[model samples]
Target: MKSIIFIETTKSGSSREAIKTADRLGFYTVLFTERPNFMAKREEFPDVHFMKLCDLSDMNVLQKEVKALILKGIEVSAIVSYVDPHSYTACTLADHFNLNHFSTEGMKNIQNKIQSRELLKNSSVTPEYWTVVTKAECKELEPKIKNKFPLVMKSPKSTGSKDVYKVGNLIEYRKRYNTLSTLYENQPILIEEYLPEPQYLVEVVVHKGKVHIMAIIKQDIQYNRRFIVMGYKLLLNPGVRFSNGLMKAIKEIVAKHGLETGPCHLELRRKGNQWKLIEINARISGAGMNNMIKAAYGINLVEEMLKMALGNDPDLTPKFQKNVYMQYVTVEKKGTLEKVTGKRKALASQGVVEVYVKPRKGSVITPPLSMGHRYAYVTAVGNTAIEAEANAKKAAAEIQFWIKESPKEKITTVIQ
Candidate 1:
């Protein structure tokens, strides 16, 4: 039987769903992960035929294990990963096995923000950006960009809004620069012009150099210390002309980067009638994106991506159309979760199709520092975008978290 090898996957969401999808499609599922104990205990992945524990960060170990699997007569059909950190590794392994996959170089470019910005520097999509690699470079570049306040600083390896910051002035720039530089010492730091609100997520699938637009979802972002995407609303009827323009730009980006096949999602913002690209990932959007897409259009993006990885034609045709909204639930303060309430209420609310909460009674929780901080979400469908968003918000509001706040630090005075 043909087998599919999956790299490290998250505890939930589309990555985990992909494993289940492959099993349902009659493929022998093999998982390579570092956290076998965590995954082995989960009843969600009972169909996973084999689970191998190894250090995923080391490519040599992964290659050796794959070779061992082949020696054991495991028919490795395709190697794939849904997580960001291991995407390039999975693509490289796919090439070694002569499997159908995206360009490894393209995947690397997608993984590294600096390289991606350099590749698209001349394009109309990217923002004005600068890179700093050393302390001297940081100091030298500061004077040049001092006037360019409200710039966004990012570590090249940052993902999911982590290590990404918006600095409003020279002081804030210095502070954020110090923090990120210290955290990612010796790595290049990306500083770009901050793109304001009304962000959009464009999901694209490319097959043998042909680009297909799957969906365009408008994002509703909320700001605390970091920019948090509070909700996503699928645009069922984004004007034909507008979509055409987006498609053209996306095609250009894909062609320029040599991304001939597989899935990629682009984060974009409309600036004065022109769409500017924020970032692009060589994978589908994470979290409840697959669920939202399936709920709205009756298409399983994860399954489609898995089919593409296995050298099969993906069906992007929509079975139905409906406005869908996904609202993320977040906390306001740092604390130990004491109790959660109203999940039943949220699930029973009108138009709510799904409600998911992550934290348990004893789980520690905090305010949004990144996308990972979002503890729960509510997905709803309606006749229109407004109604969909309203329903999701109403349902999400019904779910509440009760927590025991962390104790404040005490200040001590030293007499001289």
Candidate 2:
């Protein structure tokens, strides 16, 4: 029997999708994770066997475990992971076991923003960028590169826009770097020219030197001093011209960057007539966006990626298409969630497929300043963009947030 292995699996919806897909395919799914109790918490997954690991970052430990398994006469057919920092580890293990996967070198190209830029240098998608180690280094190189203000600084190894900042001036830039310096210590930070709006993302899966283009996601991002991805909306009513242009741009960017094997998420910005690549990573889109993909196009990327990892050709063709949107739930205030009303109303509305609110009645909640702080997301579909968008918004707004505000500093009146 064929066996599939997933490393560093978190107790997330995406992780569930991957393991369940493997189980459905009749593959014996073995999951390695730091949280072994996650298995006991889950009632499903009768076929999934959970294994505990001491450290996910230590490749030596992981290598030893897999090697031991191999010596036991167990044949590991495929290896896969959905997380970012762990992607390279997955590739490394796959290479060691001679399993099918995107190469470790290619993983390096996209894992770091600076390295990804280096790989795409001299291409039409190339954007201005710089790397700095300390505050002094950033100050020294700030005025030297392109003389562009309002640049964006980001962590080279970051995921979900954590430690990412936008600086309007030199002072702000220096300050942001100084704050991040203490956290990152010696790691280099990537600073790049801020691309304007009309940002987009494309999901592509590559296998055996072949690139299969999936959906083209139109992003609605909120940028203050940082970027908070508000939504990934469907592309409805895109004329023939726009469709051809988007497809061409996506194809060119992936081919130029040499993205081969596994599923990759590509982001780009379209300014007037020109399209500039933002960044690309070898992973599935997160934040429940994968669910939206399934609802919109009847394509389960998690399932497809597993098949790809096993050297099987999964269907890339869209089974059907609909207007679908992933709308994030952001709190307006910080407090314990007293109550949430409007699920029946939201679900009762047209085009609303799913409404997932994060905060429980007694759980503490805060405004979504970054991806980590996002409260919940709702997925909706319709025949048109307006319908789907309206449905999602209506559903999200219907769920009222009644937070019992945290108590302020109390003063004693004994003096009177």
Instruction: Determine which window of 10 residues in candidate 2 has minimal summed lDDT.
Output: 407-416
Q: Candidate 1: where is the Cα deviation over 4 Å? A: 36-44, 406-416
Q: Against the true structure, whose TM-score is highest?
A: 1
lDDT of 1 by residue, 198-271 (tens): 89999888888899888899988776688878889899999988898888789888876778887889999877
lDDT of each: 0.85, 0.73
What TM-score does each of the candidates earn?
0.94, 0.89
- Model 2 residue runs over 4 Å out of place are 35-47, 68-74, 145-147, 406-416
- Output the worst ten-in-a-row residue range by lDDT, candidate 1: 407-416
Q: Which residue pairs in candidate 2 have backbone atoms (N, alpha carbon, C) closer than 3 angstroms, thus clashing?
A: none
Q: Tell me the number of clashing residue pairs for each predicted model.
A: 0, 0
Error of 1 at 376 (Å): 0.4
